[model samples]
Target: MIGPNLIPVGIAGLGSYSPKRILTNWDLEQIVETSDEWIFQRTGIRERRIAEDGEDSGKMGAVAALRALEDAKLSSDRIDLILCATTTPDKPFPTTACHIQNAIGAKNAGGFDINSACSGFVFAFNTAAQFIATGMAKRVLVVGTEKLSTILNYEDRNTCILFGDGAGAMVLSPLDEAGRGEYLGGSIQTEGGKDDVLEVPAGGSTLPTDKRVLEAGLNKMVMGGNRVYRFAVSTFVKLVRQAVEPYGFEQLGRIVPHQVNQRIIESALEKLDLPPETAFSNIHKFGNTSAASVPMAFDEAYREDCLIKGKLACSVAFGAGLSWGHFLVRW
Candidate 1:
């Protein structure tokens, strides 16, 4: 059932970045009533990097993007588009991708930012793939960067211990042949009815910032942990199967899931009947870095030679917007 017009898009290069500041579980104990053992057993997170003062999403993204371009052995002038996926953007106007374009001196490209929370990267990847598939762009930079530490409610142990800041980018280019790209098949799904389960209550058009909201700290992230946990585990398992079944499940070589939490990841593996070692994770070191998790893991796995050429690798993630999806890549 392959479409006659189907085209391929492959990753030419990859790069990632994390801020200098490292916040450890012991650091959390100093601020909250949590123990290192409790956090380790619960989330498998020992430490996470925090963006330094004045370091915004765009800056982190630009650094990662530059590395990706360099790795691809391409100059900024060759890039045709930039897609930055982030929830913690620098501002509401100008879009973070535009700022990245200017910072990286990619004057030849025009771009936009996408917000699907932790699922942002998969969403961006799918979007960028379409641009190449339809012959709209040649070289596209797809970046997933976030400075979640900026908006975290430090006083809330439930949320504060679960987030960090970082950025990761990939250089994707069009491939003339079918089934010969960095990715093969993927799908995205959203459940707006569950939006309230994880969201920032203020500072949006629906609930503009006010003195009362600001004083109440309503702008910070809020999460119904149990609800999101349930949804994340189920969605990840379901969509992963959806993406892999089409390619023949037995052909899969490895799984690279979003570094959200150890428990959720373990649950996903259990449900899928896949071994734990088949999945690459860095949540213990980076916590939940939102969109950056997958690419960061991708870079690390690639370096460790966990993702080999012509091997089937599947990436899955779930996040705010109650969105979730998976992508099957031929590495």
Candidate 2:
């Protein structure tokens, strides 16, 4: 139950950025011998974006942040904090949040990064809402940005065909007086002992960057695809059911899930006995952008009128680290 004294937080604005480069399945045919029919049939992705030179996570994130600030009509200096969710940081030392802070001129903002992989955006958004609810911050910028192309193994058709590069951002602020939209509540969870199902094996303390790691392609992402698909299908249904239990499923306006795969989303919705249109998805256009998928889809849904004001909507994601999370907003 919500406390009367607590400040209500809501999404004030949203924006997204995708690189100009489009990698089509036909294009993949030239590089990896994968057919367009096969890829679309299996993953429901025909193409995805690839960042150009110099378009790292920080650069793309800043672009998205600027658009979000513009949409919010809020000055950069007004952001009290920035929480960036990413698996691919521009560099190991300087947090990507700091880079975004400088780029967007959010000089008054304190910033940090969260690396929950695809689920990072939901986790970051929930964390940002807490700051607003507690009176710790009036406004916060939450960003989920990634340049997965930097670490993708083009030769590995299994993983390469399913990922992309992009960024999405949202500005969270106190719900306005008499406004209908407000954050409800949600959950972030991890099924431990399953990290090995999806991960990049090297470039960290456990498996430091080295010539052997490079030769073995440990720096690139690896996944047990079948295992992940099964887990995602079941978990997506479970999270959505749990989130809507308090409000009832019929009250859900839309579901913005991690755009990992079209098949996964469709299958999950099927299990819930819902129609295909119940969920909003652009995986066919952007593929799997990990952390960026949820926010990007959210931005698209709002712009396209899929999300209705005063109705509850759920954002869910699952990815590397074997992590998954979901959050609800009445918007």
lDDT of 2 by residue, 16-80 (tens): 99999999999999999789999999999999999999999999999989988888889999999
Alpha-carbon TM-score of each model against the true structure: 0.96, 0.97
Q: Write the per-residue lDDT of candidate 1 for residues 103-136, one digit (tens) a residue.
A: 9999899899999999999989888888887779
TM-score of 2: 0.97
Q: What global local distance difference test value does model 2 have? A: 0.90
Find the candidate with the highest lDDT and give its number: 2
- Taking every candidate in turn, the Cα RMSD to the unseen true structure, in Å, is 1.7, 1.3
Off by over 4 Å in 2: 177-181
lDDT measured at residue 269 in model 1 versus the true structure, 0 to 100: 87
